[model samples]
Target chain A: MKKTPLNQVHRELGARMVDFGGWDMPVQYSGVIEEHLAVRQAAGLFDVSHMGEVEVRGANALAFIQQLTINDAAKLVDGQVQYSAICYPEGGVVDDVTLYRFNGAHFLFCVNASNIEKDFAWMQQVLRESALTDVTLTNRSAEFAQIALQGPKSVAILAELTDVSLDDLAYYHFCEGAVAGEQMIISRTGYTGEAGFELYLPASAAVAVWQKLMAAGAPHGLLPIGLGARDTLRLEKGYALYGHELSRDISPLEAGLAWITKLDKDDFVGKAALVAQKAAGVPRRRVGLVMEERGIPREGYPLFAGEREVGFVTSGTMSPTLKLGIALALVEPAAAGLDGELEVAVRNRRMRARVVRPPFVK
Target chain B: MEFPEELKYTEEHEWVMVEEDLAVVGITDFAQDALGDVVFVELPEVGTVVEAGKAFGVVESVKAVSDIYAPVSGTIEEINDDLVDAPEIINTSPYEDGWMIKIRMADAADVDDLMDVEAYQALIAEES
Candidate 1:
């Protein structure tokens, strides 16, 4: 298993470690609910170093990315970020990524850890096929260490550590700054639906930066968050996890990402298929479900509308914030209506569930 | 971290307090610590028959769901209804308020087959 730069720090903090997508990551430190609540009410810090970063640079960077990703990368200005996905020719998702545009000639793609190798290889192959002479692709996954400081108190905690005016950093925007005396890319973006910043620094400077942030955040009760709470926080906001909500066989439109999939963009991968699918209408739609019964719905649990099996849950949990059994399921479009009643087969018995719009907590 | 000296323990991490012909059952502190923030619990109804070494109910945390095993064969006489609303009490007070069920023991001798506090501590130490 691959260990992040903060692996020892997590172990020292008494975090429960788990194998997450072949990476040794902390699943929880204090506890899932407590850490989750801390992020909701106060603030939480997270080690997100395991996520992959790929740099696409050169004269054709904008053109290359625009053709490679589903979103209109040409719309992104320097220092701006766009949530986008790479799709196969058939319209199924390859991976959802965050495109960080430094300039027309330099772009950074932050992808999921599990899809690093696959996405990198795919990009290389596509670039080779496109015959883009000026473009250069580099997988810089191991060179960076990233941390997310998230919550209502996130800005205040981060403000104590850096001279950068965080007030000026708009959402989905980034700036190069010095934090804890180390050069880092501070981005006002996070998976958790909170006012947060993701700081990307050199791998060797991770420990010092983490300690400085921890010290600064301690007075405000900033707990070190782990993957367990991270999952719940994102799910509460209806954020799509790569493997669960978006997959090789799942189209972005079906995954509630139609807004990001720009069909009007000229000749991107999967454009034709997505256009056809949009015209035909998607067969399945992702919907939020709150369990009416006591059972916790789990991934792969079958969903039924009346007696007909409609779909299966993609991600489900006993929501720490809502105190309810909430889940995300991809069901037949007809069964995805709000307030519609559905049954989830949990532990072999059908449990009552109601279709509701996410974010489940808010 | 605490293991009551009077209670007997199962290898699966359940604690049983033998009281005459009945036994009050709950998970151990070590078990609760490992489970992390119990969010939901599914308990068997009173009068439900449970067999020794078989799963009787489930204890769910935010990250994982675990089965609570029956330490001794018996019929459930009572259950801790308080756990259904605030399952987190299992993390705060695993041995006392978090007790899952009380069973009318089918055989009093089954308690002897289980490990005492000292033996249970040794078991935990060996695993760690």
Candidate 2:
């Protein structure tokens, strides 16, 4: 398994390590609930170095990105980031990514760690097929380290380390600056649905940056978060995870990503298929579920409406903040109405559940 | 991790405190530490019968879920109702207030098959 630049630092902090998508990452430091609550209430630091960074540069960068992603890349200004997805020809999602626009001729795509190699190969294949000669694609996944400082107190803690006036860094905007004497890209974004920033810097400078942030954040109740809390925080906000909410078999339309899938835009990969699927109406829809009974709903557990199996859960947990079992499930569109009665097959019993819009906590 | 010297242990990390024919059962400190923060617990009915070494209930944490096995075959006489509302007690006091169920032993001799404190410590050491 591959290790991130901060692997030794995590170990030194007594983080419980686990194998996450072939990367030895910290699953928890103090505990999942503690780390999760800290991120919601105060601030939490996360080592997200395993995430992939692919640079697309050259004169045809805009054209290449336009043909590749589902969202309108032309809408992005320099230093602005957009959440988008690449899809297969069949309209199934290839990977959901964050596209950072540096200029019309340069862009950076941050992709899920598990899909790094596959996404890079796919991009290369598409470039070759399109004959886009002016565009140069480089896989810089190993050259950069990313850290997320999330929660309400994140800005206060990070402001102590950098001179960049964070108040002017609007959401989804980024700026190049020095943090702890290391050149870094400070992006005002995060997965935790809280005010935060994601810092990207050279891999070799990860330890120094992490230590400085940790020391500065100590006064603000910042905890070192792990993948375990990352999942919970995202789930609470109704965010989609790659393997669960999307895959080669699940279209972004069915995954509730229609906002990002601009069918009216100029021709792009999967546009026609997505348009056709939309006309036909999405057969399945993703919905949030809160257990009305005792058992915790888990992934792959079947969902039932009356006596018929409607769909299955994608991600579920006993929410640490809510103190209730909450889940995200893909069910038949007709059966996904809010407050709809449903049941989840947990263990040997069918537990009662209710359909509700997510952001379950807020 | 603390293991009360008087409590007998099962290889599954359950601790049994024998009082004549009744045995109070709960998970060990090591087990609770591994499970992290407990969020919910599903307990069997008080009158339900359980088999030795069989799964009787489930203990859920924020990240994972585990089955709590019955160390000895018996009828459940009582359960810790407080855990349904505040399962985190399992992390704070695994051996005392977090006790899952009290069982009326079908065979008192079943205690002989469980490991004593010293043997249980050795088992944990070997596994680690």
Per-residue lDDT of candidate 2, residues A1-362 (tens digit): 99999999999999989999999999999999899999999999999999999999999999999899999999999999999999999999989999999999999999999999999999998889888889999999999999999999999998888899999999999999999899999999999999999999999999999999999999999999999999999999989999999999999998989999999999889999999999999989999999998778999999999999999999999887887889999999878999998999999899999999988988
Window of ten residues with lowest summed lDDT in model 1 chain A: A317-326
DockQ of each: 0.83, 0.80
lDDT of 1 by residue, B1-128 (tens): 79989899999999999999999999999999998888889999999999999999999888788999999999999999999988989999999999999999999998888999899999999988
User: What residue runs in model 2 are displaced by over 4 Å at the alpha carbon?
Assistant: none
For model 1, the superposed segments whose C-alpha errors exceed 4 Å read none
Interface RMSD of each: 0.9, 1.1
Looking at model 1, residue A20 earns an lDDT score of 97
Chain B TM-score in candidate 2, rounded to 2 decimals?
0.98
**Which residue pairs show backbone clashes in model 1?**
none
Q: Model 2 residue A311 lDDT?
A: 95
TM-scores of all candidate predictions against the true structure: 0.97, 0.98
